[model samples]
Target: MAQLGFEVRDLEIFASRTVADGTAAEIVHREHQTSVEVRDRDGLSFFVNTAEPLESDPAADGRLSVNMLWLTPDVPAAITDLSNIGARLLKTADNGHIADFAAKNSGKIMAHFAKTAAHGPLGFGYHGKVEELLERLLAAGIDAHLIDESYGRTLHITNPDFADQPSNPTGPTIWVNEEDQPDQYGYTAPSGTAPQAARLDRDSN
Candidate 1:
């Protein structure tokens, strides 16, 4: 998301894997997945697998999830990037602060974008079983919430070692969700529902 202001990481290390001949950012093609590691301004590194299936598993082939939702300084530019990729507009906030878009053929929202830089850069959802993952996190003494939704189970866990961010008072959170019946990231919101983008410190866990 270099276009959206996230910085690419470890470019030198992936020099041999660089495949984009003239692209601004170095697009690295790993053996099984074509991905580039990137970090937000907050130094949170996110592993971005582009287009291809993250793993060689057949079940996950051609599917990608909307794992991270970020707040951008520029919303229109972000919209251009998504629009260039032909992402479908799923929802948008009335006051134009938030928008959710999903890639073609994918069940989950590809990315959630917010206009203001006041808060967040929040992320949510996991590719696997949330209940099992939550249990493990709880065992490790992490602060987490396990919420059962009509579609599946979800967990909201507080980010560790990052409690001092003023913009993110409650620190950032990592959301995990169980796979829905369709086997893709099947969480869907009914059209016209207000976008309840998570806040920094408002923990209902």
Candidate 2:
């Protein structure tokens, strides 16, 4: 764990899927989730380098560089399902359940937040144009709902109770350095700010 640059025992994970206009939410979540800026303009993706999933992407295989994040072999979806279950439990205030799930699945982990994508094109907050994001989410097969103007964007595909919950006027309690995206469409985020970030930071890399 020391060699990995963190105390493994203290690690916690958070996984998110882009539902509505996640660009802004992605920015905030990046504060707690180690994130990398990635942009999808047309069919081309712009990043620090070529992008591909670690499972089959040779570029992400064992390559250790500031630009390239190394990863483990792909864990079966059954294992990732545990992460999904744990994440939902954590969201619902079930820490004990997450602990139990982690105790079982954290050992053979590779990377990812869980199933990400909008449950549908429901807008949350963040002043950016919601239509564009709505189109993206719809494209991904999520459903559509009302425009969320309350500045509470991030849609946790799990917590149904969180739907009507009021947004916290005070932003996040924890603070972090702000990193810039490389260019107009680039994505930027922390490296290992949180365990969840560590998990989502890679995907085919």
Candidate 3:
């Protein structure tokens, strides 16, 4: 973890996916499970989890799935690390904001990395118009939703492969946000001082 410049913030465990999402918190109080929260040098923490039987497929190979998006300061260095471990490069953003890779011969993206930015850890996105993408998805008979956010316009679509259960109507979804989105981090007050500038400075300390 230290070699990768990652910091472990906290660890948590949940009985099921719904419990982890706060949906089944009242019905299911406890169960055998565990999870760890890890963050890169940029302070974006993502969870590595182990939930009960219902949350995930026990026999499925999870390596073929892309679950989290990690941010790194050095995109080339991060790509080198993945290549060193036999991971195959799938695609890279022309603007150097994102990189997708597959871990094995499965030909499926297992991990994704985005450039460090001020939009928080959820800043993973691509270069395109959100409205255009939404229209394309809807025209293709896919269920998609759009949100106009201050940071940028975002679109989320349900995973076509996800098996929706009664307990969880919305099984799994993907986020499609405009790349290089604007955020409060780039703001400067009229007095010539930025509010979030101080926060960023303190966070670095």
TM-score against native, each model = 0.40, 0.17, 0.32
Model 3 ranges off by over 4 Å: 1-68, 71-124, 164-171, 182-205
Best by lDDT: 1
lDDT tens digits, residue span 103-133, model 2: 2212212122223311111211222434544
lDDT of 1 at 37: 49
Q: How accurate is candidate 3 locally (lDDT)?
A: 0.41
What are the clashing pairs of model 1?
none
Candidate 1, residues 70-174: lDDT per residue as tens digits? 456655554444333334455554445555664333333334344343223444455466766678778999999888755457678887746665355334666
Q: Where does model 2 exceed 4 Å of error?
A: 1-131, 139-142, 154-205
- Across 125-201, the per-residue lDDT of candidate 3 in tens digits comes to 44456777678779999999988866457678876755644223224666665543445332222244321111101
CA lDDT, candidate 2, residue 203? 22
Question: How much does candidate 1 score in TM-score?
Answer: 0.40
For candidate 2, report its TM-score.
Answer: 0.17
Clashes of 2: 15
